[model samples]
Target chain A: MDHYTLLNPLIGGILIGLASLLATVLSGKIPGISGVFGRLLVLATPDPPSVAAATYGVAGKTWRAVFLLGLIGGAALSFALWQSAAIFRPMRPLVVMAIAGLLVGFGTRLGGGCTSGHGVCGVGIGAKDSMAATLIFMATAMVTVFIYNRAIL
Target chain B: MKAGKLFLLLVAGGLFGCGLAISGMTDPARVIGFLDLLGAWDPALLFVMAGAVAVYGLGMLVLRRFASRNLKLPTASSSPIDRRLVIGAAIFGLGWGLGGFCPGPALANLGGLRAEALLFVPAMAIGMLLAQRFFGADS
Candidate 1:
């Protein structure tokens, strides 16, 4: 705690806020990563025609794809510019990681949003559902971490 | 969509990724540390969320007044708190705690070429597909 610094996180958070703002203003879209990614998956895979229409339309696919590619490109650029921008530390085994991914994917879809969707953009707009979802997920995550630390670790 | 909108989307996505990287959210260890409430907790994430939410909240308020027509905002739903929301969030939280990665950070890490993300993203996609197919989850 003594060694913690606040400048970077603040700046980064502002950047994220600005990104969301831009997305909304320019494209009229909420930049929720899970929703964006999930819809893109629907487009790529052959699913029920109803599902495809219900989610992403043909016109919607290009922007989502470009946005995601930009996300990846931005991250790659950051890593290249700042070599220490990301340091990978494997906490759990590969199996655990895969399972975690599955849960995240399923849960976000089922729940209707992830941290970006609910936590940031949803909360930003003062949506009650987003607020409730955010609190529920945060509490559950904290409890899970507590159990993981005590029992798993 | 228009080329202009597409370009802006790209820029927005890039900014989002840069924010994640710069804020250290791309690191699962840092995320887990923040979540480890019982252990030595780091409040950096709180500040990040605060800063982001504050800006976004204000921005949306002003934007709605000026450009509501042009904006394709998410429609407000009338659904109440239900089992689907609770169960879904709980399941997502469990996975988040286990892996210490959310969708945003996980994808960003994949871009950074992290081996963990490589394994995680595919599984997440599969999970999303399953949820959509079997559970009729909304995308």
Candidate 2:
């Protein structure tokens, strides 16, 4: 707690909110990372559904690709410009990371959203489903952490 | 017209990534610290969520006034809370708590070319494909 600071998080959070708002205003789509990424994967298959095809279309895929690319590029740019000391601290083993990734991918798809989708955009817009999903995920995460720290670690 | 939309999306995505980086959410340890309620908890993430939710909520309020056919906002799901939602979210939480990475941060980390992201992202994509295949595309 002694090393905690709020300014950066607050600023960063506002920027994220602005980004979500801009995406919706300009494209009329919720910038749910999981939905965008999941649908992109589906679209890449040999025989994508007509619904997905129609939804994504040519421009749809293009925007999704660029948006994702932008996510990577933005982070790179941030490191280059400021916070040069930022580094990834591996908290879990490689095996744990892989398993976690699998669960995240599966769960977000089945659940319909992630933090940006449900926690930010969904809860922001007062969607009941998003709210429910957020609460459940948050609580579950806390419980998991509690168990892991006490039992596993 | 199409190019304009794509450009805006790019900018939005960039800002979103930058925000994630700046807020320190890109760090798995920081995320885990927030979740470590039984341990020494960090409240920075709480403020981050508060700021994001408040600003986005207010923006949506103004946007709602001008809602039109052109504005394709996501509509609330008609279905009530079901098993899929609960199970899915719980599974996601387990993964999140374990890895301390979610879709947005995990993808963003790819920018740094971190080894963890390289491993995590591909596995996550595979998991997504598995879910779509087994659960049907609609899920």
> Which candidate has the highest TM-score of all?
2
lDDT of 1: 0.82
User: What is the per-residue lDDT of model 1 for residues B1-139, given as tens digits with 9 covering 90 to 100?
Assistant: 7888789899999999988887778878778889999788977678778888999988888877786485666544565768888888888999998999999889998787888899999999999888877766463
TM-score of chain B of each: 0.93, 0.93
Docking class of 1: medium
User: Candidate 1: what is its chain A TM-score?
Assistant: 0.86
lDDT per residue as tens, model 1, A32-149: 8888888877744465777566457776677888888888888888777764465556778888999999999999988988988889888988888888989988888889888988
TM-score for candidate 1 (chain B): 0.93
- State each model's CA lDDT, in order: 0.82, 0.84
Best candidate per DockQ, number?
A: 1
CAPRI verdict on model 2?
Answer: medium
Name the runs in model 1 displaced over 4 angstroms: A1-4, A43-55, B137-139
